[model samples]
Target: MTRITVLGGTGYAGRNIVRVAAERGHTVTAYSRNEPASPVEGVEYRTGDVQDPEVIRAAVTGTDVVVSAVSPRGELEGTGKLRGIERRVAEEAARAGVRFGVVGGAGSLFVSEGGPRVADTPEFPDAIKPEAAELAAVLEDLQSSAAELDWFYVSPAGGFGEWAPGEATGTYRTGGDVLLVDESGESQISGADFADAVVSEIEHSEHRRERFTVAY
Candidate 1:
């Protein structure tokens, strides 16, 4: 089984990933600022300030894949803290020969070819723009990383988040760069399904050193 560690294990996206990975029998570890109130069984939970370099190093050292599900929000919003943490984790993962994965935002995805990004659209919320920008920067950093560093960034559909939390259908569509949408023009995916997609990537090693999106 693949050994996986999620840096923001208690967050919305990170917790789902941890649950799914553990259910799949993978050795999973979740490192977060605080311990989860309802921790997943068979998963190890680690608490620490991600700003510490030693914590990042320890989280990346032995895992086969290290996923960063942290987002820029709360105290981290507008601080550019998530980007810095992700960059350091990426560096540590590379040094340790572990695959790096980032759970990114849909803001960076193109609404159409060679055009404005989702975050750039007039209808997008201004408050979320900063978070999206930081996540986009994380993707850029991964793209420019060394060739030996295997990494993948995943941007979920536009309607993703705790507000929706759609049920897993065990099915979803995947795309690159462009945002995936249904015929109704709705772009969304369940947290469970998104976690499934991530674990599938971990097991299959598809889309190496690239970014991919998920939607219904």
Candidate 2:
């Protein structure tokens, strides 16, 4: 079983990942600003703010993988603040010699080959622009990280998270930078299935230091 540490373990995405990882028999640790109301069984939970690097670094120490699922929304909304946060995590991952996998946003993905990022589209909703823009930079930094970092960024299908939590079908389609869509042209994946894809990559690095997306 792999020892994995999940930052933002209490958030919508992090909770699902923690649950799926634990169910798969991986040694999982959930770290967040506060303990979960109902912690997943067989998973260790650590309470601390991600704003503090020491707390995150200590969590990264002695772990095979670090899953960064931190959300830059709500109280920390609409800011390009996660760049520093992700850099700090990258720093610790490099120091501890652990593989890093992050649950990235869909905004950074290209709508076309050259450089038409999703965030650049006129139709892209204004509500999520801040979070998307912030996390997009996080993905950019990961892509250009040092060769020995052993990191990967996985962006979920557009209809992800608590607002549109779909049921797990135990199936998902994976693709690179360009968004993945079903025959119906809907870009979505269940939270559980998204976690499954992330863990599958963690077990075997398919897109090392690169970004991939998942959809139905």
Candidate 3:
């Protein structure tokens, strides 16, 4: 079984991943700012601050993969701070010979080949621009600054997150940075299916050191 560590383990994506990985018989440890309301069975939950490098190192050191599902909200606000957390975790994972996998945003994805990123789309809203832009910077930094690390940034389709809260079909489609849409022309994936894709990739190692997306 792969020993996996998840940062922001109580958050939506992290919590789901922790549950999925644990259910699949992987050794899972969850690190977040607070304990989860309903912690997953057979999983170790660790409460800590991502800003502390020592805390991050402790979480990732002996794990086979570190899934960074941290979102820039609450105590983790600010783009620079978010970037710092990603960097610290990536550095620690690299030093410890662990893979660094990120739960990335669709904003960094491309609409067409050699085209503008989703964040730069004219139709993109200005309200959520700050968070989207920060994620875009995270992707850029991961490819440039943390290039030496074995990393995979998994970006969900456009209609992901708590707003939708769709149910899983035990199925999902994979794609590169280009946006993916279903037969109904919708860009979405259930949280459960997203977690399945992640753990499946972890087991199979199909996409290595690159960014990929998941959708219905």
Q: Of the candidates shown, which would achieve the greatest TM-score relative to the real structure? A: 1
Ten contiguous residues with the weakest lDDT in model 1:
71-80
**Per-prediction count of colliding residue pairs?**
0, 0, 0
Q: Predicted candidate 2: what Cα RMSD to the true structure?
A: 1.3
Q: What are the per-residue Cα lDDT tens digits for candidate 3 across 1-216?
A: 999999988888888899999999999999988889998999999999988888987988788999999987777777677888898888888787888899988888888789998889998887778888777778887888555688889999999888787897997899999999877877998888999999998898888888999998
lDDT of 2 by residue, 59-89 (tens): 8898999999987876556466677888988
Flag regions of model 2 displaced more than 4 Å.
none
Per-residue accuracy of model 1 over 1-216 as CA lDDT, tens digit each: 999999899998999999999999999999988989999989999999888999999999888999999888876777568888898988888888999999999999999999899999999999889898999999998999999899999999999889999998999999999999999999999999999999999999889999999999
Backbone clash tally (model 2): 0
| lDDT accuracy of residue 106 in candidate 1 | 97
Best by lDDT: 1
For all predicted structures, in order, the TM-scores are: 0.98, 0.95, 0.95
lDDT of each: 0.93, 0.87, 0.87
Better lDDT candidate (1, 2):
1
Better of 1 and 2 by TM-score: 1
